[model samples]
Target: MTTSSGSSSHVTDARGPLHTGPGDQHIYYGDIRASASSDRSGRDPRQVAVEELRALRRRFVDPVGSDRARELLEDKRAVMLTAGRGHGARTAAKVFLCQLPQGSRRFRELVDQAEEGDSAGRALDREQVERGAALLLDLSTVSSRRYETFMAELPWFLKVVRECDAWLAVVLPALWRAGFEHVFRGLVVRLERPDPAAVLQAHLRDVGIHVRRAEVAVPELEHELTTATMAQTADLSEDIRAARENAPPGSGFAAWLKTALAARAPGAQDVEAHLSGLDSGAQRALLLTTALLHGARTDTVHEAAARLARAAELPEVATPLLHHRTLTARLAEIKAAAHRGRVRFTVAGYDAGVRRWFWDNYPQLRGPLADWLRTAPGFTALERADRLELVTRFAHERLRTGPPDGLAALAERWSGPSASPEELTMAARALGEGVVHARYGSHFRQQLYRWAQDTALPGHRAHVVIGVCSEVLSRRFPDQAMIRLRHVSRHREQGVRVTAREALARITDSDDRLYRSLLKRLAPGEEPRGLRDLGIFLHVADPARMAGDATVGALLADHWTAALAHLPPRRWEQPLRAWLERAHTRPVARRPALRALATACARQRAAFGAVYAAACSWAAGDPARRRTVNALWEAAGSVPRPQPSRTAAAAR
Candidate 1:
């Protein structure tokens, strides 16, 4: 019953010959024979069987039948016995049989053939006979359990299997398919049966096969292990090798046994149960081991760390395993990998234990700290103090070595509300460097503004940054420096306010154009506080000579009018004296500024009359001021008086 297609196309039954397909072939395992030319044209029957098995698995629960199907079953049986444990295959076979049409004649014929082929040197090939035995054990029905009928079918298959050393390998898969643990227990029961050899001898005698020797001697069985003699008789080595080779990822007897005994942790419950059973010391050791190998990044490892932390009552034990040289040294390679950014974990305050462990070793693990600061999750979970500490440390480290390329951005990030004094200083220094040295200074200008608005930054620290900025800007960015100093002057700290004001004064005094520029930016009624003092220094403090300068006089009149109006009457004498003396002694060409000063002073006649009179006397000798003096006198006299109140009229 073979064909060139490599699948069995024909089978003989009471109905005579049946053709399965165009090119099917049948293989006889017990007797090796050369096939006809036509039968040899296609693939090997074993390979075809493997392909069909894979196809069946892919189909998942498809019905299977036909002579070719029977042939493929034989192929599975052969491979399962020799190269694989029958567990996976037997399970698959049961499912496949369950899916077959119930009353299909072809399937029934295959079942009958499987039964008849069970005897030694029977009508079927040895492989076919083995498949028949597996089929019978896996035959499930509503009336009887699959394994309950194993004894009834045993007599038939026992004839062929008794001669084979691999009988256990062949039969175990069938039993395993029925129930994983029950099969192993059943083997132990059979082995421990009193005079098991005699029981088999009786069965053989009933079949008219005289057994001269007790070749089937049962060995004592222990609950833990099958006896060595029984193992040898069953050829356990072949079964073990076969199981390993052919077991699917999560199937097979070993996998089933592991599942049954909870050997491997398949989930959290299993893991928890196992740890629960350990002694306190063992549990601690397990936690330490987990911490050593798995950081808190993964949920499982984090859970393990949490469990250990809960069990630890003392601070010493609560310390993470990474702090222990005994554990950490062994994981140096993993640490190296983590440092290279190949692995990611956050030691932030998301978990107290993780935080303590990470920070303790942060110095050694700083290689990835910058990247983590930039990208790791849970950074915000760190407490404000810890964040400040880490950010400051990183900023200083960056500044010292000259930040790695493109890493200056991290320094800017630290200049926030939570920024420590050290961190704010670093941020300011970075900004100063960018302004003075980096080509991308403007790019960070907005960042500086943002930092400026961080009101939570300590006053002293903010003052320091303001100082750095003012100094840098005075030289390199005088215009911006003026604005920044003006803003900082309004701060709540008197020292900071004074520092900014002084900085503005120095900047204004050093550069006249900058002084004028600063004045121009001040709105008429709203003079900047930083420059309020500057107006006095320039216009009123040394006013005697300053009045003689047109620029100084105009600046005073335009923006510092209120400052001018508020200047003490006593302080006005010096500028007026200097103006009059200059008019009297110097040439007329310079007198316009003095005259302008006189007009501005006359406008403030209520406050400046006495200083104006002193100036009039000093200017009396100057030819240009003869009219100027009379004009000043008249201007002073024409000052309007305040209106009386209605209450005053009632009193009258």
Candidate 2:
């Protein structure tokens, strides 16, 4: 295609921006214009983002290395240089941003160990930590909100935000150092007396921090130093802490509340005294929160409730704890914390304390925790809503889990409000529907096992069967229900594997007594009847010979119909495989049965019923058994006897 321009045509220069081809789906903007120049190579867009991020860090960085911010710049620069692609760069940035807020924690730890002369490093480190933390907060908000239009390019945003976080760290600490609170102090002075005692007392007076003992007033004229003078001194922190504790709530108001409290709120100790003085429910709520803050972990209903009761008297607050204003506030905060998706109790001791303290503060959170745990994987299977309530209460109230303890802190949380067994059954049914529910049931069953201390074979078998069945149903037919589960009868304390004598008795009962005199000599456990046990009675009745019976073939054919009528054929295979693997003696019955079932299913592909499977699985495993069955069929002229010999039908 060629075009000739007339005299009125537009003029163009040699260096004119040429129109490149329109971009495909990757352009992100949906714009027709391409980002690449006419002579550009098809390099990755993420690379461009990384380069831009590096450039941004350089823009904020000061070269003198004197501005502690250089450290931040260096960190961000390293990420960009290492992150060559978009995802790499973006992920790095996201992680850094997430980790930045934690930097303050690092700073605080350093400050604790930091010595006298390393002041510069402490100050610098402090700046870095706080900035990192702030940056992380911002990045989390932005990334969560997805701020960029060409958002497919994550590396660019990551690099930019990471650098921003580093810079913020450097800047924030400096802002604090720049008399952020002293500025407030100056304003307080202008507004009122700037009296440390008065200001501190005012903030704490109505709040829970009361004067356990008032300090002897130091004469103002005698000391010569005001709140400002003491604040400026290097030992001000130590003095402020002592004063906050001993000189009344407001004694060290200017220094303590403004500086120290800004970094770490002083509540646990202050409110704790009042907590002990409150009624049981209130005290329990508080202690639970405190425990959580200290990194305590507990889930047993009995244990948690007991701990709460032991730590704080619940009986005292039974009447008014529900209505207390402080309790209400504390519950609201803990709920908010849980919603934030960071309910981990991992701090050395603070998390545990916080957890127990929080529960003590609010008795109502018991409902929410129960509801939450009900939806949690293993916990959901709890048969009783009240059981869930008990469990959550226990976790919040009395548990102490962390590096400090390896034991499950047991304590009863619900001597007052336990649910009925019917409620538990309903809960169990709902919870048992999912894999998560199965896990919860397993946990609950284990608890039962522990209590019974009866690891007897029969008891163990019952538990194992239930667990295995639940797992298979959950994993294989995720959406299926356990309909028609009329009863769950558990076997008593029998040994693990079935004994020969018992097997004989079981088989005798399982035999089709239609020709009672015919099989009078049959083993007790090896019943050949298809209808008496619904296929399960004969399941293990015969230890030596039941499975070898020729009737098993016809029996399977008959029972397959009922099995299909209950569970759809699509899901039958898993249960069948499970039964074979667990109940059958073959080395790898489950996998082989599964393979055989799959092969049998190849033809039907979509259609399924009981007869089809029975035929396919009629005689599997031993080739000799298959030959004998064929010979037997021929010998009887295709007439199957009521029951065949066990040895004759061995595995082919």
Candidate 3:
């Protein structure tokens, strides 16, 4: 920097004349590969000059008394980073460090003006600012003293920590370990003390970044959580999980329910009510998404999509409210479109499914349906339906190639009242044998068994299912008949063979195919008997298994007295008693005959209570039984009980 001061600060071309280079310039260190483009001249320097001065002060100033010197270096670093490059970078830098007398307003003005000039984009250039910003970090790094000063100037220095990935080999460790505390805690610690490498190693250990002591390997982890969950980290899934789990008691997601309730959340009983009640598909979609953020499941989103899909296929939904009946009035329009191969177009506003339903049923919609199918988007989407329908249709077509499954037994389920027991038995056996080789599903077999439990009568409509060779399974195995009559009489008696459940247990359980096929032919509500009944009939055939009538005290209502007279006192005792006690007890109590039947051989206790209740009541009528009855009665306050003897005494 000195032009003539030879003794103190000399600039007199003092390089050792290595054979006297041609010009005044000789390679200073034998390293003249290229001249630095940033070689400075006398141009108006940027406010970054202060940055250079600060760096100079830090390098030359005494370490023990260098507080302001460090602060100036920090401000300079911020300038070089945020400001742009310019001429006179070196000389302006040296001039900035020139010592000045105290009480001088001019020096302070220069500092403030330089900062304001950099702020105004007049000195610190934009591109240079960004390049300089690359060096920013809270912890020390491997860089020149000047570059370190540049990094110190940034305000929100940690922003670079997140947005800049390449810097993580050093800075991220500091940020992670101490949460940026290293900058303040390590303030008094001079850069020469611990040094960059030592600072980095210690930071890595403190932050738990798992760095090898000397290795420079950088690791990038995958982000498991969404952006909303990430504050400043890519692999913070563990942190998020912990936070969610230990949310403050009485104040986390559980408490959200109370908050939602306090606000009178719509349909607290049914979360989906908002989505379901919406007439518009778009509105429902909005609600569905909101519910998701509120912790609704993915299935709820899928369901909303499906609802819109189905609604879009309905005429009532697809048509504008004002134009709902337009399809009917535009009959000629429909015909013209059909003539032009545009039938589908005429039905454009109507839901294709609704049109098809009308055409398939009322015949009037046939015209519209045909016209629409020719041109509407319905046929376009129908191509996709082809794949779904293929398997079902294949199963149906295969069925027709052979005999119908379980036709014989299934025929009995659909038989008329005139069908004789022999005819029914033959039909049932044939149907049973037919299904032995059929590919009947378990669900179908269960249904068939249920049907077997029911008796179909003549002149009554009983729905039967038929397989189609055309449509898919849904349509192929169509439920036939408008109604299925379920007469309880056919299955009333136990026999050698019966419904699937009542069939041989060990035998049927092993033959899953037979069990399932049989179930399919059965109607709902009628169920199979258990393994016990089946075992008794197949393995033992005990008389007890075949036994019917259960004993009960006889009771003749006056309404059926004439019919009752025809019986020999035991015709109705069995089932009526079985039904009264739910067939639970062995023998229905005699109810002490309301005086031992000495007065009227009738159900005298019936006047006051049911068979069990009356019998119990009658027992209670005895002084001996009353004690037990009273004890029980007092224990179960207001409990209801009936004792026949007691009732009879009261009646008397």
Candidate 4:
């Protein structure tokens, strides 16, 4: 059953301060302060991944075949983990990679091979497989066609992994094992589910809950352990932790256990029973509104409930206000409580249960609910936190149910030309939730790709798409993020293109590989777009950011060669002079910067002449600057220029 103790409780609300945990950092649009952390200065995604790995390590219990998998991985540098769904194969793969010795190597989950029929062959570029890198290729969700394509390329991929001395753990789909079993006989490790009791115990202890074996040996707990998957067991442990924290100060473990158990399996039944007694349309509207905005202020909930009633075409009662039951009494009848000013269900996680029951049992109401949510954020006095919470709740339900297009349609509507700034923010946040979802992330990526390539996309919608790319997708999927941003950078709207360019520059500058990737993508263009690319190149090519690394120096030289070949001296003179000025001032950057510039000019006489002219003008007055220029010119002259190409000679 769906419960609030699932990932939903990790969502921050207006009732409390936001906790900046590892899980919290990836949420792009929850709190304003949290949102600020998603900018250029945000925590590195690699570091965040490592922190999550560490957190996983704390709660992870080794499934059966883990040792064999590790042995195979160490011996072959690649191991295929095969297990049925809910057996923790993905987690086991990650844990295997995490157990490797820490070093300068990269650790990341590689995106799947592109879908069938695409000429790209495999999405895993050769440049991505660096030496000593630890990679995970989770193909559990691939379609049959994609899986066949992956199998065709698996041999070459493994060969590359071996050549690079890297480690790889592939989580294969269980259904396809027989088809490829003979081919990868020795490489496959069939993993079995770990003991549910042990999994639950580890999760509980990881969260600082101490319980004895005897304390957890109840009949109900035993039945759950026997029947539940590893994921559900972990969810039960989380529910217990949430229940304990929300329990009264002096409540014992028994009380928390009872509350958690009731919330875990029977929460939907509880909601169904509660809703059956409520006959009035207004009462039902208020109940559903409270579920969506559980921690909102009571006044906010009241106003939103009325709005929802109107949207659903629920008839207004003719009873006088004095004769009607008060809001507090109605709330009591619906099993919700108003504490101080905030509203929530009296039973923990019951709000989530209520939401699930309504969405699952009444399919027709989904349209009215979507329409109501479109204006609920605006008409109600929702704080930023409340608005974020509303969007997240709505997104979670939509993604969990069928037809994911409802959330997409609502987000697009909110991002229309006439939508307000608040509506736009809500739209972005709603899509952000989808981008970070475990199951529907690929769907949202495809959706954003379509939006990015649309010629008629509105400026406001472009802004929302760019915000999701920079803020949400960039954290875990930098490659996809860069691709989308580059597409948006070519948009007709100047402001949208500029914002996309800035985001691209910031994201690439933070990592060497990404920087090189962007340079390669932008270095081959011609004319007007070439000019824009040059501007982005200059913005990210600061020597201070490079830290004078030799590899960065080489990349800088290559980019300069492209720039020199395409643009006139006037187009690049200022940034070239700025580099020379920095060389004159900073001793550490002098050698690498000068060498890169000289190397860029080594092959063309005209390029050499442009650098020589720029340097002479830049150092006209200062003696030291003059000496640096002289040295740069000498280096350029030492490298002999190549003979002109046949095309160039014929043109001349």
Best by lDDT: 4
**Steric clashes per prediction:** 10, 93, 48, 0
* Deviation of model 2 at 410, angstroms: 11
**lDDT, candidate 1, 345-435, per-residue tens:** 2221112233333434334444444544443223223332333333334443444344333345655454455655444544444455554
lDDT of each: 0.37, 0.29, 0.25, 0.72
**Predicted candidate 4: what Cα RMSD to the true structure?**
8.3
- Model 4 agreement with the true structure over 124-217: per-residue lDDT tens digits: 5565575677788888876677677777777878889889888889888877546663557788898887988888889999999888888788
Pairs of residues clashing in candidate 1: 3-25, 5-23, 7-24, 7-25, 8-25, 83-242, 86-173, 543-575, 544-574, 544-575
Please give, for residues 246-349, the per-residue lDDT of candidate 3 as tens digits.
45765542233233222221222233332245565434332322221122223332333344334434322455668643422332322212233222222221
Better of 1 and 2 by lDDT: 1
The runs of at least 3 residues in candidate 3 whose Cα sits more than 4 Å from the true structure, single-residue gaps closed, are 1-401, 405-417, 434-438, 441-456, 459-613, 616-652
Give candidate 1 regions above 4 Å deviation.
1-425, 436-439, 450-458, 524-552, 566-597, 609-652
How are the candidates ranked when ordered by lDDT, highest leading?
Answer: 4, 1, 2, 3
Better of 2 and 4 by lDDT: 4
Clashing pairs in 4: none
True-vs-predicted CA distance for residue 411, candidate 4, Å: 2.1
- Name the weakest run of 10 consecutive residues (lDDT summed) in model 1: 29-38
